[model samples]
Target: MEFFKGDKIYNFMGKRLPFLGFSTILVVTSIVLLLTKGVNFGIDFAGGTLVQVKYEKAAPIDKIRDILNKTKEYKNSSITKFGSDDEIIIRVTTSTNSVSSDLSDEIRNVLKGTGNFEIRRVDIVGPKVGGELREKGLMAFVLSLIVIMIYVSFRFEWRFALASILALVHDVTIALGAVSLFGIEVNLDILAAVLTLLGYSLNDTIIVFDRIREGVQTSKESDLSKVVNESVSRTLSRTTLTSLTTFFVVATLYFFGGEIINGFAFTLLVGIIVGTYSSIFIAASFLVQLKFSIEDFRTKEVEKIKKQKEKEKMRAMFEQGTV
Candidate 1:
């Protein structure tokens, strides 16, 4: 349990300011990058054609891509392997602003191979659907933040509420910025992953805050910041171990979760790492800076009971000494 008997490093707390500064700088730089080079939204956001085809045997992905690339009809198309290397999905931009059944027939003709194959699915999403999805995703993210703020404020205090929200926003912005930087396609699944990360990050923060709260109640003689530092130090082992275990699982998904869940797991991996850092350095440190006091911690009824007990102990000691 006592992984770190004393503080791991005597002057470890001083590095917090520099860490905060670097995080702030990175966030600003990411924002600038995003503004200059916006997110490359996938076909799920921008409307396009979708075609899923399965082969009897393992198909040559490069050959399929070459076929799409050489075809005059789908000159500007993005081809990807879904499910497995044998299953191919293609998306082609509309030329005449209309999605015709004839277009699917053309794609089938181009994809017609020597081996046995089956067209599994085909659908065309319009710009209207993309717009609606974008709106809904925005609403979901905004609603999640609002709910988190309300819950943290009601459960803990306003300072903690603000700190947790800031951490969540930081995690989200970084994830989005990373996806944009990598040209990863952001879709409905990715948005769902983002929401899940928000909850996961907040759960880590709440656990650390709860530990700090416990320290404040028990360590009456220690400074509030010291109490917080101790609490975080004590929970560091649990935090690191939990994150590593989760990371291994998510890393597995990232590598082999297929194309569909890969983006989701990638988002999760980044969120969990950053979430752990924020819980320790940002969230707990901000609470200490906010002057979280033991007095502010206890309820009025508890304080009254404590004072009555102290008075009774003092009276008993006085009577025994006089006798």
Candidate 2:
């Protein structure tokens, strides 16, 4: 089924500049926010204790914070409501000598008289381990990009590879920026989400690229712009259907997945939207700017013909000289 009807053509390439500008603004804003405000790194990467507590009744976050602050040891603690008002998550940096069990007990004791609560879970990460996790997370992201570039280069061409990589970067940057902007906690799970997004965006981009490749080989259109535009139009339905279904699922998870997986789902939600936009506008439009044409794909055949003609000319020259 087609999302767009009739034989009408949409000029997706024509408006690439504006779309690129918009993306540039988003990426820059994200970078600036990342530098200034920074990501709210969770216990997984920030070396801390995370305590999840569920109260019998809804509790005021400010009161909980006030109660924790009364104890000098817990004065610097950060308290936030988790999935619901009745659930609270408390985070505190781990002391050099404190054990995870001790930290949980201390937190429980501090808030004991304030409300009837149960400790659902406690997680601890030491400074050394958190540092390692942070470094590994960054490495994972970089390696994924390198692998994706290599795959795209082999599957298509260098220009397509570069375009796809740039588009992926754009999608990732925008997603991270959204995370930073909204003060979402960045953790291992969120990193996994970003990687998942990388794959999703790549899949969408490859579909468009594959269609464009086919159009170049089979379509009568000579203009690269026309070919790209037609290819995108033809694949519009598939792209829309895939993105919509994925978006719906991620949105559902975001709203109801609880605090544990909220970051993961949120990343996917942003990435899917940005990824779809980049595949349709940024990736294919970049090919037109690079002067990509059918000739580029037929370079080997053209070179062979040139060599054959040169050989014939040399043979003719030798025969004439001998005559």
Candidate 3:
């Protein structure tokens, strides 16, 4: 399980330029793809009606799809088995911004002869609501990014924070690009996945940054590049272990979790790979470019000294019974 040795000093920073070049091309291509072909929006962001049906017996999925396709009114309808073999959920895109109250009844009527089925429930979303949800999702993303930047800025130097934020942006942009490129249906669940990705990527970057900061402070080496390489090498095993563990779980969900969660699983799968990559290559590379100064370490030392002085002062006051 140990992918790297404890004392190994990997030269991860040695070929950082080529990795940076590759990342730049990838980020640019992803941006282009996103612009030219936007992600496919689902009912969570696009108005539609969901009809849940339960058949008396096992449902014929393909036959039901064919039946829906042949009907001009429900030609664009999509269906998937949700619960048991006898139950299924059907999503019908509304031709207009409004949804018909009798959509479920109409679906039942259309499939009357196919099987003895009961309409379990129906959920309708309006275009206005969907639009609002879409706006909110985007707002959440932007606000989270801003908050993380502010946090990192306070946690470390401005340059380190800037680098961390850029790496986050890089991870998100490419993940969105992959969703767009594959024409994945972007829904509320998928939005959740994207947000999850931001947290995951940020955690990885923070781990590496903390190590680098520690290495810079404690090591005698004045060369920032050497410090970065050693820091990354030290933390490589932890990062890889975490990434692989999460990837395997998400991969299982993508493969066996069924169609209901396909998009969500796929989003996480891509996010795991891209997030892990950007954390090491993109975030760490940005750190190398920023050039860590010993002065940064001095700031921490000053704070520690102040804290120690405060502790000593409190001890004296307590000993004299004047605390």
Find the 10 residues in a row with the least total lDDT in model 1.
3-12
Q: Is candidate 1 or candidate 3 better by lDDT?
A: 3
After superposing candidate 2 on the true structure, give the runs of residues whose Cα lies further than 4 Å from its correct spot: 301-323
Off by over 4 Å in 1: 1-12, 53-75, 80-88, 95-97, 102-104, 113-123, 289-323
Tell me how far the alpha carbon of residue 78 in candidate 2 is from the true structure, in angstroms, after superposition. Answer: 0.4
Model 3: residues with Cα > 4 Å off, grouped in runs: 52-91, 95-99, 113-121, 295-323
Put down candidate 3 lDDT per residue, 1-323, tens digits, no spaces: 77989898888788899998998988999999988887788877997877888898999888899988998767878897774799998888874534446777678778887889889788777778999999999999999999999999888778889899889888888888999998888999999999999999999999999998888778888888888888888888999999999999999999999777888998999999998988777798887787757666677778999999999999999999998
Evaluation by TM-score, superior candidate among 1 and 3:
3
lDDT for position 285 in model 2: 76
Compared with the true structure, the alpha-carbon lDDT of candidate 2 equals 0.87
- CA error at residue 180 for candidate 3, angstroms: 1.0
Top candidate on TM-score is: 2
Q: Each prediction's Cα RMSD?
A: 6.7, 5.5, 4.0
Judge candidate 2 at residue 184 and give its lDDT: 89
The C-alpha lDDT values of all candidates are: 0.77, 0.87, 0.87
